[model samples]
Target: MKSPQALGLALIAALALSACQDKAAAPEDIRPVRYIVAGGQAEIGGDSYAGEIRARNETQLAFRVAGKVAAKLVNNGERVKKGQPLARLDPSDYQLDLAAKQAQLAAAESDLAQQQLNLKRYRELLAKQFISQAQVDAQQNGVNAAQAKLKQARAALDASRNQTGYATLAADADGVVSQVQAEPGLVVAAGQPVAKLSQDGPREVAIQVPENALDAVRRAGGFRVTLWKGGAPLEGKLRELSADADPATRTYPARIALSGDSRSLQLGMTAAVALPARASGELKLPLTAILDLQGKHYVWTVDDKTLRVSRKPVEVASIDSDGASIASGARAGDKIVTAGVHLLREGQRVKLLGQ
Candidate 1:
């Protein structure tokens, strides 16, 4: 019903109204974030390290001679006393060797006796001037050679007897059989472990500690071990510490000797070792505060008066549950944005909540 000029004017008015509404609905440019002042150092309880129970004197019992295993005298977990027989090899070969050496010795003895009789007869003949001196001297030489052969044979017999005795493997100390490596009818070589014996003595807890915590562990005046099952804490002392770090884990292997009664502890039990963790002189920030820009690490630090955020480049020493420990680029009293860091731009204004 309106004319062309009137319709155009109305359309312009509507457009102006929509533009005003859009301006009113525009989002705020400043962002709100939560941050923590980095000054107060974090409190850390003793570092927990996982370890296993072991024996101080774990021994491996092996055979001294190569042969087929004829008998296994003890089973796994069996208690044994010193000099107890744990396994035996087939003695047939060793016994036959001994018999052969004995026979050779007896023959040598008989030869020596005959040669002595000949020497005596030669001496008598020479005294009567019935035989030449050279003939008598030859008989004496034969007697001396026969006696040397007898001595050599006797020495070989002793060695053969020792070999026969070696066929039986015996425990060197009081222990409990923890493992069996061979069985009856299985052939084993000399020095091959047939069983593992855990000697009945001091108990040890073996653990691998990170290189960073090694110095703190060494300086710890005392130690305590608690079972993973939540048993009473057992007093402990460092028994052995490895000088070299493990190549794969980059950790040092150490052992703690348990004091008092360790009868409740079992082999292969999981344990947690509590060691004092002092301030490592590193600033720990929340993991959310760290932002990776390219290959470098960054965080948003809030200004005290301006309430503006500035991007801070920080070097992280270690990352754990507490957060990332900063090695540099951040000081003890700096304020770092913990949340909504990605949405913030450098030099942008921000409102600190609970300020």
Candidate 2:
């Protein structure tokens, strides 16, 4: 028979051993994580910019002469041909000025004819010895002065005629009137925009690019434009890029010319331009996936078979609003943990959120 003190000691040892076994058999903590598949069908490191479909050539139409607008001949979105009347100014003042010039020209012609007759008479008198050579010379000088005055008057008359014709504003090319800025009663200065015209021709996509992406945009091979209303992506070539940033938006305005069959594109249609990635064949991951320890960068990659998370050292080429571009360490079709990266450890068992 065992002693009471020995029985107590045995009981205590058994309880301790049971506790140890329970702890050893317990399951490990499995962290649930969100992950992304790298290098899928979507191109990594590329960018998309919202833009608008616009005519390759848009012009602000204005009158050559300042006057009170008498009539606006074209409405918004109206198509006009070259030399077609677009708007008209009040012709009352111009007509009166033309009449005055015409009257002055008539007076000058009458004076010139009278002076020529006098010169002829003076020469005849000199030939007959009735008048001195000095008198004939004076009459000839008067005729020459009259002729010069007549030419001046005629030139003034021609200018007046042109001014009268200018009272009616005409379209310089075939286009659609996108906007009208003047009313019939408004008095506008010469060269002040009265309407906006979109010339008929090839179309372009107008996009605003940030300063940081200017180099990428310049180096891109080409662009693909997709309309907001849905259509096949159209190929585009960079046509114009503003050297100076826009004061209001602080973005560089860029125009991408569309190639092949842009006739269906209308002005002001919203679109998006896809800019190619700066570097090709590189994996891209979310910024959250990047784990920064000290000065080095790392990502949490998942094992396909074991579903274990491992810390991966990666080389980041660049980081932007889109995400981070992985230059090395990660490749296409690799699964990466995008969330809860800071709490994860190497070889930690993980449960994919959607799996």
Candidate 3:
């Protein structure tokens, strides 16, 4: 036999060798991970803008001629028909001016008749050799001048008549007077807005969109408009979009035309317009599921059969508070690792935490 110290050393070596063998034979680590289904009904958060209901054909009513407003025929919110008088200006000055033009026209007509008679007499004298050819020609020229003056006077009289009629501002179309800017005794210039008329036609919603969301708004398939006074949501289509941003607000003004049962919608009603997210059919996932490496975006997807995690490159469309909208590289029913994405490796076996 060996000495006691040697025996102890040999035993220790054998114990260490057995421990190494046991460690080598141990089972592989199976990491538990939190995961989620790639494709579901989850949608990225969309944008909403506060808007106002308005007529699609709003117009500013104004007088064609400058004058003092004598009377305002219609008040605010009054329904008016085409050709209905909205306001009246003082007719005293216009009437007096019309009278002056009429007098001038009468004088011109009388002068023209006298000139024609003188020209006929001169022609007769020339035929009888009682007057020279030049004299007859001069009389003809005088008649021509009188005829021109008569035509000018007639045009002036017509213009004056039109001015007098313009003293009464009338509605151009059937509409409701939304605003009355000119009151009785207020002097207004030509083309100044006296009232605002909302024509009876299709109703629309006007909304302001920020510059950052303009692209999404433009690409949206449709919109939903909800009224503030509690009514069913109305379907809407984008009708118009401003190319330039508003200088003061730095927002783009857009108009959405409402469809189906807009009769109850009135002008100036507050509303909200919902703009859907741009990526319609793309899959969405939590932001934590995505991994950024080497200036590229990727995600850890788990295999269904093997339960193995693998890095997948994905095309990211947009990221918001809701989640990341994936454009490609992932499909419906694929398991995606939501938590511990960075710790996972390619082809590594994993156990779903919840499952």
Q: Could you say which candidate leads in TM-score? A: 2
Which pairs, if any, clash in model 3?
A: none
Lowest-scoring 10 consecutive residues by lDDT in candidate 3?
38-47
Each model's lDDT: 0.87, 0.89, 0.89
Cα lDDT of model 2 by residue, 84-180, tens digit: 9989999899899999999999999999999999999998999999999999999989999999999999999999999889888888899899999
Q: What tens digits encode model 1's per-residue C-alpha lDDT throughout 30-65? A: 888888877453433467788999989998888989
The 10 consecutive residues of candidate 2 with the worst lDDT sum are 38-47
* Better lDDT candidate (1, 2): 2
| Residue 334, model 2: Cα distance from true site in angstroms | 3.2
Instruction: Note the residue pairs that clash in candidate 2.
Output: none
lDDT for model 1: 0.87
- When 2 and 3 are scored with TM-score, the better candidate is 2
**What stretches of model 2 exceed 4 Å from their correct place?**
41-45, 277-280
Query: What does candidate 3 score in Cα RMSD to the true structure?
Result: 6.6
lDDT of 3 by residue, 1-355 (tens): 8999999999999999999999999997789998887665444346789999999998998999999999989899999999999999999999999999999999999999999999999988988999899999999999999999999999999999999999999988998999998899999999999899999988999999998888878888899888999878888999999999999999999999999867567789999998765354668888899999988999988888888888989999988765888888988778888888888878999989852
